[model samples]
Target: MTSATNPATEELTPFPDHTQLPDSDGTFVKNWQEHPQSILLTDSITPILKQLHPEGEYCIGQDLGIYWRLTDPPEKGAEAPDWFYVGNVPPLLDGLTRRSYVLWREFIAPTIVLEFVSGDGTEERDKTPWKGKFWVYEQVIHPAFYGIYEVQKASVEVYELIGGQYQLLSPNERGHYPIPPMGVELGIWQGEYQNTDLPWLRWWDLPGNLLLTGEERAEQERQRAEQEHQRAEQERQRAERLTAQLRALGVEPEA
Candidate 1:
């Protein structure tokens, strides 16, 4: 639903300083209502999550705070990416825990950045609230791929940062972008993720096949095994019938 209560955070400011931020045991869902987009987009990436990190070593949601501080006193700095995926970093931030992803310390940049465009008036023309985010991610964070998905409508725009500039990445005929780093493609499919099938992002194999979720994969395996078992049983029955016919003909079957 929403943020889980942390007993450690007493008299909590809606926004806590980096140093004062409480330590979490790597649960990104905490305080999610305060930041719903983080959960929504992260959920959108579920099929690709394990494929991105089968070992669960390198990934961070918005709550981890891997964003540039844009505001004086850094109020705007809290504009975390909806969901960002980093490659090849320790699963945990420090040897202990991390409050926000500090660029200076980690020396790591997310390979992909996703933004959910809430229906704000100015977002249409790349105005104030939205432009600031783009500038920061492009100039400051410089994430390789930046994507924006609108919820109230059906539209997804992805950007690729190349040669010190952000360029609009066009989708193929089927509206999917091949992400070489993740070894798959991402697209806006009208399928379910987190029980809501509202244009979720899905991952595909190199041959452009949809990647299966853990549940879907298990179901596939079970179905395949059942098919194989049935085929083997049929073969055994055929062999027995043939052996019986040969013996009846007085031609002893050689096992």
Candidate 2:
């Protein structure tokens, strides 16, 4: 997607002046695994979307601060989801670093927001008005889909916005919640990712195929190449044996 630019000066304008906007206040501190998990989830999802819609555009945030002024004091109305995705928006605005995602400037709320429940359980499910993450997402940001993944329980709870309120979604037979708009399912996978052995929240296609990371895709390609090489070598050896047998029988095989 093309970044926002000033037509008058022909200069790149990523975002409006952020000084007037209330950015992050550091209310929530991230755990060690939180960042990695967020990265894993976003990284795995983006490539699939790109492949499916080559002309599509998307913006993904991993613990990136999101700013919104829903109250009289703008400072009090900002909340950042662990991982969020907004479609039809530039991945980066004017190739500049984003201080925070300003909803007014972007003019679009994230399509999906995912929160990884921290060990302390500070604010993952907070529903207090204006201050809680749940309240902010449901009332203010109003993402189409909201998901909370608890690593301890190895469970995922997905909520879909219906009639302006978030309703808990039911999982399918494979225990995955289908996100129809995205054509993907959200679920927990018990496996190792980035050398960490744990239950990781991941994405799957509607047909129950797991969305693979870049590393996993590369590994699969390598294995396929190796198999092809072995097959070619076996065929070559078989042909050579047949030629040798023909020569021994005093009938030279044609090249």
The lDDT per prediction is 0.66, 0.82
Q: Which candidate achieves the best TM-score against the true structure?
A: 2
Candidate 1: tens digits of C-alpha lDDT, residues 1-255: 899888797775454334543233343442222244455445435656567777776766663566355355443454466577887776664465556666655667889887666556144225344346676777777789888766656677778889977788888767788778877777766766555556655567667787665666788999999999999999999999999999999999885
Q: What TM-score, computed on C-alpha atoms, does each candidate reach?
A: 0.69, 0.83
lDDT, residue 11, candidate 1: 73
Q: Which stretches of candidate 2 lie over 4 Å from their true place?
A: 1-29, 51-56, 70-75, 120-122
Encode model 2's per-residue lDDT on 1-255: one tens digit a residue: 998876887866554444456566656665678877887887788877787557766777777667777555655657777888888876666776566788878878888999988765568778888778888899988899999888988998999999998999999999999998888999999999878999999999999999988888899999999999999999999999999999999998887
In order of listing, the candidates' clash counts read 1, 0
Q: What is the Cα-based lDDT of residue 93 in candidate 2?
A: 67
Against the correct fold, how does model 1 do in TM-score?
0.69
